[model samples]
Target: MRFANQTATFGVAALLAAQPAMADVTPQQVWDDLDAYLQSFGYEVSATESMAGDTLTVSDLSLRLAIPDANGGLSMAMEQMTFTDTGDGSVRVDLPQSIPISVDVAPEDEESMQMVIDHGLEGFSMLVSGSPGDMTYDYEATRMTLALGSLTVDGEDIPRSAARATLSAGPVDGETQVTVTGEQRHIVQTASLGELAYDIFGRDPEVDGDSENSGMFKGSMSGFAIESDSTVPMGLDTSDMPALLEAGFSVSGRMSYDASESQFSGTEDGKATTGESSSEGGSFEFALSPDGVRYATSAQALNISMTTPEFPFPLSAEMDEMGLSFSAPLSKSDEPQDFSLGLTLAGFTTSDMIWNIFDPGQVLPRDPATIALDLTGKATPYIDFLDPEQVETLEGGDTKPGELNALTLENLQVKAVGAEITGSGAFTFDNSDLETFDGMPAPSGAIDLTVAGANGLIDRLVEMGFIPEEQAMGTRMMMSMFGVPGSEPDTMTSKIEVRENGQVFANGQRIK
Candidate 1:
């Protein structure tokens, strides 16, 4: 969400840079033009301007925008904004502080209740130096905070309460470059929000409907930070993607959310709540470019515990690590691009109470459980995903989404429930004959999969009364029809293939 806001900010700054430069212009005029430019894009700007020698100050400047079909608006307001001529074809910009922001939404029906939110900051200030084409800024604040200001229904306020956030980001810095053409501009920009720490709580609200039964929620995190960079054409419609295709510019970013400590808790009606969760720390990374997009995320030492009045004991579980990563091409072209994805989980364990409820004899392993897949595929898009008209054509079924030329499985593995499974395969598709596969791409290839200790696992389930005798017999018959016994005891293997004649085969026998 922060990344999205930064992208919009860059677009706004670029629009301002494209305006007439200072030569004979006053700082007040610069801000006026900026305000007007923002208005063209559905934003309302309010401010009071004053000039002191060569320094110009804009007080209580606010930028607001209302949501469509909603009876509410969002705004960001500053207390003192100043611009000083540096006498070198540049200006120094300063924001002494910011006022608390308020957001309220009231349904047109006049009966639906809503929340009012307010955010504030302390020791807020910015020092920026730049000319019309290029600008740089460094910002600092002692702390940033937010709260639920109130709750209202039918224009009447109700008693409400919320906990403050212990949020702090030491400092932030950024730079933006604007290239003005006849009437359009190209922009490149980057920004970084330093390490962030937050601890927030949601106190029990004073509501008429449920005064006797209420709950409170609390959460916290530390050592999270984000940085981003992007380049794109400004003042041009991106829906058609003409500018994107011509410029080939893209947005990319890196973030580190490796919080040192994180936790959450809740209570309801003087009893432990039904919803509770916690995590020691986690990290996430993301990036986007013309060639492709990618993301990598992981969390560590996670646990969740919950209960209900109907259950005899609370359910609790823990895991040491969880991770995921994926990458895919962003554009369509004659040449093939690479794509892959993977997931992993380790050191999973459950509480003794949970184990006693089922596997009292401890038939299952107390070790980690894991499942992972890695695949590489090449695709040639029949329609540009970024093009509005082409997208509409595909959405309307006037064309296929794309063509999958080739696919190969690098790895496939799973180890859980007293069994291990693994497989790999390769395939080529026939996009010209989608009808043969019921509107799906036709493929011709083979895949091999093997399961170890399957028979033993089935026997254990039957012994534990998890599967009835009739069901177990049916399962065995189905497996025998499609699988061959492996050399290893209790192991089974199956071979699946798609034939060129549009037929499917299992265990060397035609099934379709």
Candidate 2:
């Protein structure tokens, strides 16, 4: 009997999750124990579910109160609901197509009230069909409604009133449909729209079994919009808080993996902000290999015409492309083992920029010119399972013996504000001194850069107030004697070697 009750009551959630039914479960048992479960929750059953062939139908039931959804308490009075339990081990429920809640708060209580829900679930049907692992319930519906009034948790009036929300989700293996909705009807408050969430999913069959124990996953979103300007954060306490993807959003993407390698790829497009400047466009891709992971990103034709409190003015431009790629060896312990890095930029030029994107503090000068860079480096590990002097035994993987050294080449280039140069150098040491700082060694590397054009650039800087008149004259003197940044000061040249020990020279002429 206890087993029958447990299996019967769990049918709803089981149907939702589509739990397998090939074990010990049956339809007669569902009907025999379902009403008892409903009655246990204090629901006065007005009628028993009728039967049509293999389906059990329960209509004209009043949900006086449900297990207090999330926010606690039930508000609607005569909302009709229906449930159908198919004799073939399946169940379904039809809820109000649209449910809008109205809050009647006095002006005095308005400040105490945070938000109100207006329009909500109109109707939905759930299906508990299929085996245990595949059992699922589906729901669907049109638009929902909502309304709200301004209130404050700490003390403030809201700006807008009333909101409406509705949700819907897929064809689950040709088994179930799910839909949810919310809105504000007559409530005159700023926070009207109530609990809202939406989501969608597609099978990733390609993730068949290429990689080891891990599988690859990828996805994309055309867009998603979240609007809860007046809702109070405190009103969320229930466990079944809809879903992230279930909200108003769109996307598509893919990914896959094998024991040693994996990859993910996708793009996103949608309104980031509101007003005359709201626009969006961005994409990202990533891949993993024995060497580590690599990724690229870009934001095209995005609207920079945003005017925030910091800018105080309209800012605009296009981030043609900017990206970075790096990979690191799996960790040997609590500490990281090996590492590598690389970065790049193309058509990445900003215009009328009030603040610098790289440095939000506005410490560096903004550039109106093009930019580019190429860099790569790596770091070795310390622990050697090959050598057993480390410890008695290891846990996850292996343990480091005494200490480790990072053999690295911190090479890089830049076309940054006030400078354009390239250099190659290393700062990480391999296995040098191991007694000073625990077991980790030092870092060492060198860099060589070239400023292809120096005269025209210096001239431009001098005119732009970056360089003073006296400094410009002194610069000319230095140029004639030595060479410019990349070449001889007088004749335009091509590269400069900057030693790691702090030495600067161009065209064989030592500048520092």
Candidate 3:
């Protein structure tokens, strides 16, 4: 029970009493010990001072780490951070920052991270300890929870919540096992679809134990309730009311595991009740590493019927599967993992899916669509290694930009909307800007893919305005497209080729 309380859940309130290690060690020794500990983790510590016998202050402390690029490349620099410890087991670490910070992760590589604003701390706090294995740190709102309207994660807007955590340090075997558990309660506006989270979804339906242990870290938890009904945010030119009838509404069950990685498993076992009609249930699960790697999967069984507010026909999405996975930044020499997904809209009985795709703008080119998705594909970057900036930040005075590194990606693929595509590639970002360092364009890279899809894509594109009605009539054009639309069932075969060189081709003929 030594750590039983903090282990129960997030918001656990408990502080470690004075450590027995302090018995023979003076505060100065504690400061030195602490400083040394941080140094092992790549931190730069300048001073360790003891005040009034028990108080200690460590100044000029900082740390640096490297993050991934869009292509899974590493930055040539390290991320920078500073911290101040009050010596009372409480510490305030400055936010992670960049030297001439670009505010973009893999600034030179990723394509989907469009908004690109990044670099900063959400928040964190932890109890300081020694014996190497006995330590605890809790971070409740790292950037991950901001998907909701709360301006941060879970759509909850509050300064970061706290999570109490620790590792078994003083075991007789000198074991180094760590464990953490926590939660954050955030308020969300019903208007934003992002306002809800699994943390707020379903209650285990029954929770019983010491009232004091409820919500404490390392404790067992049961019976929880997370239910919410909200609308997706309305974009420019889009009617606010339509989202209430068109957006995705869901509920889920969640589970967590903490080992070498922090993983979460949640089944869509909830519902996606679209528009006025709600689905019976859906489920999803995933494992995410602090370093940014991810693994996930989800499926849903939907049945809905509505008439009053919106949506033209009653719908039923009897079966569907969505799979996704991605590995974090690749060190100069790390291997790449594929990120891909598969979705099947069987019983396409719902006019909603068709409506969503054809009228994706939801504000323009309103057209009709009816199609089935049986596609597969893959995604991986052209490179994965640190750029010079990243290297500088991570070295933190110990190493320099010239240090040697490596990065590699094997293969990545995905399928859906009637297309199957695959590709592989890699690149490196060294300290020299090519302009001064060596002479080259930002260590460029590339990926090439072969795709073939169901013929339905062309007519759908014409209907969706992606292609002209005339273009849809040509068999040669369909063969050259990246993929065919799903609206025309008779058109079920086409081959498409795409490459970093920027060209679309079918049978070696350029079409775009």
Candidate 4:
């Protein structure tokens, strides 16, 4: 139920944001442009318009759009909206204080559900200005909110107390500039908010005079900001995302926040549990185009704690920094396209309670653990993954979708307890002779790695009974066979190589 409402809210918001405000816009022109924009996306738009001297009043405005791949669609209504010509070549937009949005979702083989959401605003203002090919809009608000109004399932209304959800943001300001060229609309937007928050609570209806499950979630973020740039084809159907992309739709955006915190509590089967998490700061970036897609996110100083009836002690963990990033091509290409992936988790540590369970005598160093990786590669894609028809063909297993041509391990590091490892490598694959590698692409490359404190860590593990003495001996013998001793104590270095002829070597010794 909550999931359904959230999906509707996000869908409506995205569609609204995607609508382009045309240039040389009068009050009537602006309204006409909005109507055209919605109609282009297959939405049924209806409204009553009245004019008085330099002002236009739009009443009973309603919009309906079919939900793709679903049995039902979405409907939205607003009581009133007003546009006034300020006589200075600009227009003012007055929106209703409250807007109601309704969605009907009928999943295949499931009962239909209806959800109503109320969007509210306080002290909001919007102004539109500029000429025939370019336009600008400035807007601000003291507070804005969205809350679940009602829910109906199988023609029966659910009690209000059974579910509740609300999201709010305060003191927001934003600006958008739209420029139209031959057949494309270029849009740039920037926005900032002082704070944003959400709360959701749900409880199963009483059965036999007793409730079996309930949960609540609350969270907040401060100093939120975002910037986005997009190029959209005119008269494009947004409902068909693959078609839209093929029509030259592209977007890039970045968002950042100063601080965030969240808490959750739930009860199930007579057991109660709670959890909380906080982060000092975080940022996210994304890009999408006909050629490829990219996403990256990073956070700093994260802390988490949890408590449950099944655990006697509270569990906690902390990290100084965390990050993840990935990029890959989406369109087909005869030549190799660039791709990269990376992950980092630095300065990670957990509570002593967790460590004590495994290391009662503290035989190993209690240092912060870190893991990092950076990889770049090249691959030729035979078919566009974003195209549904090509995806179906690929899924049918009639032909390979792509081939990996090259890969470079630019960086790698892992450190924990009393041991550490670091390495870097690059490889190129041959697709002609898959049989030599057992139906896998053959690779030719070399990786150089260094290890420190491995023997000491193994000894500590043996003392803790985590590793049998015989197994430890075998491990040491294997290490000696593959690596040469480094200058430092308990340190070893090795170079692993794979030849084009399928031969493998470690430290210049032929291993296969």
- Winning candidate number (TM-score): 4
In order of appearance, the predictions have TM-scores of 0.74, 0.41, 0.29, 0.93
Q: What is the lDDT of every predicted structure here?
A: 0.63, 0.37, 0.31, 0.82
For candidate 1, list the clashing residue pairs, or say none: none
Model 3 RMSD, rounded to 1 decimal:
19.8
Go through the candidates in order and give the C-alpha RMSD of each one to the true structure.
5.8, 17.6, 19.8, 3.5
**By lDDT, who's the top model here?**
4
Candidate 4 off by > 4 Å: 1-25, 40-42, 206-211
TM-score of predicted structure 2: 0.41
Q: Ten consecutive residues with minimal summed lDDT in candidate 1?
A: 13-22
Better of 2 and 4 by TM-score: 4
TM-score of 1: 0.74
Q: Write the per-residue lDDT of candidate 1 for residues 1-512, one digit (tens) a residue.
A: 22333355333422222222333334555455455445533467888888999789988788876653356765667777677655554455555333455555666765755554455545554433344334343444565544556666666665544434445454444444443444443444544445565555554455323333444445455555555555544454443344554565456665555445444455555544565566666767776666777898888888878776557788888878788988877566677677778786777777888777788988766556677787878887655565566677875666866678889887788887778899998888887787888977899998888988777788888888899989988999888888899998888999989987799999899989
Residue 426 lDDT (model 3): 50
By summed lDDT, which 10 consecutive residues of candidate 4 come out lowest?
A: 11-20
Model 2 stretches with alpha carbons more than 4 Å out: 1-130, 135-151, 155-275, 278-280, 283-298, 306-314, 322-332, 335-413, 416-419, 422-441, 448-450, 463-465, 469-512
TM-score of model 3 vs. true structure: 0.29
Instruction: Give the Å error, residue 90, model 4.
Output: 1.3
Query: Native-vs-model 2 lDDT?
Result: 0.37
